[model samples]
Target: MEMVAAAATKDAKRNGGTPEWRVTVPEGASVTVEHERCLAARAWGWLVSCVVALGAKVSGSGKRLWKIGADDPRRAVHGLKVGLALSLVSVFYYTRPLYEGVGGNAMWAIMTVVVVFEYTVGGCVYKGFNRAAATVSAGAIALGVHWVAVHAGGELEPFIRSGSVFLLASIATFSRFIPTVKARFDYGVTIFILTYSLVAVSGYRVEALLVMAQSRVCTIAIGIFMCLAVCVLVCPVWAGQELHRLTARNMDKLAGAVEACVKDYFADQPADGKQPPSDKAEGYKCVLNSKASEDSQANLARWEPAHGRFGFRHPYEQYKSVGAAMRHCAYCVEALSGCARSEIQAPHHIKQRLAGGCASVAARCALALREASSSVAAMKTSWALDLAVAEMNTAVQELQSDLRSLPSKLVEEESPAAVLDAVQLFTVTSLLIEVSTRIESVVDAVDTLASLAGFRSSDVEKDEASETETKVKQPAASDPDSYEPEKKHIEQV
Candidate 1:
């Protein structure tokens, strides 16, 4: 068998193929062969596993992408709008007459579209305006400097050009550090620096500087027009609308968090030793993280023109105040959440005493927040909001009274362990009161926003008032006896 195996190996090697070994056992026994085929099988298995893993990864990425588009179809529309803008701008390069007009600078239009087209109309307009202004202003300055440098003689021309570039660039860079400039004009400053540096440096080697600057500015203007047209005319996403919706949504989330926290704190624990789900209790965390989004939306909203229910000078800044108030309330809600989850719980009897009052305050506050959200979303003030807020204030007063009565009860308990529980309960009650206070601030901010934005009075309020008046008059109309005295008195007068 050894000689046969050695011969087979030699034959396989001589044939320039993988070597195979053959082993012979006793005549009746089953024969088995181990060869490179096993290695090949292992390699195939590894390759299959790699392919499966790669497929899974690709599938996961595809699902996430799909989810993004599904979550907001605006993303897909924005993408199409971008494509349309780019296509329109590309006409400058594709059409012969337009190509002759801009010459070789047509690429600037394409580049401008890519850079300026944004998710929202206000954002696109903001960037487009900045780019156009920066390009033109920077070009004019660069041309003036170039003209001066050329007449200064060759020796001093380099110094003049380089010095102007350095001085202007430094000033522009420094201006970006200012809060107002950074908030409103940071992009403009950046573009100014880039355009000025490019035109100034290139001016040294390129003659006909005026024509070059003109062509670049014209192409950029063309691109800006295309972007503005596409963004505004087709499925525009208004930054003001986004800010309004976000502010309202945050209020709703805060309301849910407040109600959830109070209810969870006073809830009876399950006998199965399972913890309750905390998804609603944690809703306020989103409100806490929304400061940056609110600020960005407000800033961009300022650039938007009057559209839909918004005016030319909508109170974008007031949204920030609303966000601030919500965040304050959210912080208190977070504390309430912590108290709910704390191990040092108030005695069941004590909790029972305060539960109704706490729940009433929470429910009233939540209702007021929801009403406020509805008012903001509808761009109208509602009687419902006023009523809800008034109820919340009443509930808060009642809760305060209930809290005042708790001290005597706690003193009666007087146990050391019970003291800790009372302290925890006090912390929760204090946070609840603070949260209610902050909610009032939020409501006030929304009211201020409504007034500043010129929000109309809701028809629902008017209809209800009219209905009440009709009911009051109908009784007099139907009951002739009630109207007879007034008619006789008027006749005598």
Candidate 2:
């Protein structure tokens, strides 16, 4: 009798329909009613038939697969077919009692068919069972409360109040235990809550209520399993993997852009103080803008999945860094353009041009054009740009070293310092130092930009500028035009 009562209690929590308990309550000798009113036999039967009919109607209709003009139409059709089949099977099992006895071999066959279908379709065997477990637990708890109320001669209102409080508390308490049930059984928590909510509102015998709940739960499990089975047996879609691939592809494109920008910088005369036309700087600016824009998009695309799937914070710093680096490159290109124009327009009488000097400048400018246009087309190629930038910095340092080896006068003449007064020279030198500081800062920014685009930096360091001055070769010392005729005449050859 105790075992029978316990089984009845368990069945009630499941929202089982029409349970027959041996022990009768004081208020009622026996009770028979549907458990889950929402999906009782009448409603379940219609819903199942409707789903099957819909599936049959659209069996080979390509429209079902390509609901939207997206990829993989077959997967959708497969899901529909499996879902329809599962629904039909579930309806058959639930409605079996209409034609046959409830506790007979027919009910057992229905349960077996439903469970087998669920396991085969669904990937996670244990998680699939949580829904059923929750319904059963809820129904059992509700039934126990009702039995106690009737046995103690309590009113329906008190019974409901007690049942609601217990169900809510049970869900909360059992949530801790659900995690331990299986790795994928996290959804079990929701199943019980939903089942209890439905049962409490419907006044019925525990057995009847559990039967209805079980039927509903079986149907749900079938649907879920069908979807899973179709996806696994056919070509499954993985959002995480797709998102990751998209991010990687965009990064590659951005890397290409970076390479193009870097190569262009080196080839462009304006960037490194060589010159061609006045419009070159403007052209370079446009290229930089386009590449920067592309890189921005790629960077955002990389973060989309991270933020969407895992709730990671959006990378605003990367966007700002790329923007700032592009701007700095623009400024450098403009400055180089101005220097190149100065070299070109200088009076030929003042100094003879060195062999191939003009051609070298032109070649540099041409290289920049080609790189910006072809080799490095996207910011994704940041690694190549980083290498180029490092090379440029090295070349600049070498040039500075060569300039220092000459006399102090030569240093003043070679740099912008030649035109400045003593105070101005000091000020200009300080300004140059400040500018150099900015140059290094821009280099670091470039490195960071490359890193964000998934590139590594080489082990090259820009040694700090020395405070001590080096000797320089003065141009005036060797200039025939600047020689005093009397002094040279006295020392006649």
Candidate 3:
């Protein structure tokens, strides 16, 4: 076949194209080069399909194999890598003359590859190391127990060997409940049970117990190595990087939510606007939904090794505090929404002032949130977050003063319905103060995250001049709407 191909290539070069093909017949067996090449290609194609099928089945990707689209590329890459790794291990075993029968039944190695391969490289590495450690520890223990049972004499040997399985099972089961073991070596217990059963129970029948044990361990190790190599070396997907981006996206969503909520909250306050109560509460959903996304990515990021600039799972740990801050912000929004639900009539002149103040503060807070989001996305310090915190504090103080200047007490001695308007105004003031206070922590949370992600002070550093700048931006104290536009409108005895 090689000679025929070479001769055909030479003819094609000389004549500018291939001459008419002729097949040399072997009497009754008409075997042609073309037929041989076609058969070879078909066999190769069939082998690939079979391997892919087996790999998909083993790695649990069989169910998702047909989900081929933008969302399914990760699975496809994982399955392809798994199939390739399995084939490589098989090749090493089959081609080596000395491996002959030793490599023929390397199911242990195959199983290791199948079980350790995960979507993320970090997950694969973690599982691979855990599996290898468990297999070795369990195999060693099994071999030791088998030796002890063997020397226990002919009469008691069977009993001791049988009891060893139960004993090992009990220990393995109990050890798995330990916090440290459950956290790190949970899989090891399962491995201990299987390894011990195989070595102790099957050792009696199989005289080559030691050889079987050695082969099993070797195959498992090979499988783990192959899986780790492919998962790490081939276009690896990182959980930490994904988490960072997800958090940033969520922050952006939160900004939009706040912007919308504030716009609705203050709309048409005897001014020019028309928004429903439901519209005011819509922003809270984004903040609430953000919690779930933040949680999932944080958990996955924990499994990821120290990635990029993050130190050994540092980025994952910060999520707890950051998530807490976000939850607090969500609660504030909920409270504000509650206030928005109640219709509150205040002095007509002061209504515009209150609404304007809240709208301005909300806009500032949203801007800060957006800046924090960008800082997290960029993995740098955000002085803008700190600036937002100060603005919220100032707003809270202003709201408190406004609350104190209101006429009739919200906790009225008069008819409850008579002071309903005062109570509503009080509720709005209190909710606004709470929202401002809660928003103050968001910048700190984001800043802490930035530091943990390894962004230094020099990188997007903050300035103390923001306080002076914020004061400058504050509404003048003598303005008609300043502090108490309704001071003269207060109903007195």
- Each candidate's TM vs. the true structure? 0.86, 0.34, 0.66
Lowest-lDDT window of 10 residues in candidate 3? 271-280
Q: Give the range where candidate 2 is weakest over 10 consecutive residues by summed lDDT.
A: 461-470
Q: Which tens-of-lDDT digit does each residue in 236-345 have in candidate 1? A: 99999998999889888888999999999889856653336478888899999999998998899889888888888788999999999899889889889877876657
Model 2: lDDT of residue 382 = 30
- Predictions ranked by lDDT, top down? 1, 3, 2
Per-candidate clashes come to 0, 51, 0
Tens digits of per-residue lDDT for model 3, 303-393 = 6666567668476768667667867887777666655544554434444446666666677767777787777777777556677767766
Top candidate when judged by TM-score against the true structure: 1
In model 3, pairs of residues that clash are: none
Q: How many angstroms is residue 412 displaced in model 3 relative to the true structure, after the best TM-score fit?
A: 15
Per-prediction CA RMSD (Å): 8.4, 32.9, 21.5
Ordered list by TM-score, greatest first: 1, 3, 2
lDDT of 2 by residue, 1-493 (tens): 7888888888877876656567556543233333445458768899999999899878756665565435756455645655654555455446756324333223432443343332122322333456557656877876665556556664565666456767696755576675444334455666566566666656343446556655555555454455445444555343323323433333233323323333333333453454444333344355345544444343333322232232344343444454454455445444444433443333222122121222232333333322322221232333444444454445445434533443355345565443232332222222222333343454465345444545322222111122122223333566776567867897996
Off by over 4 Å in 2: 1-133, 156-191, 203-207, 243-247, 260-493
Q: lDDT (CA) for every model shown?
A: 0.88, 0.44, 0.69
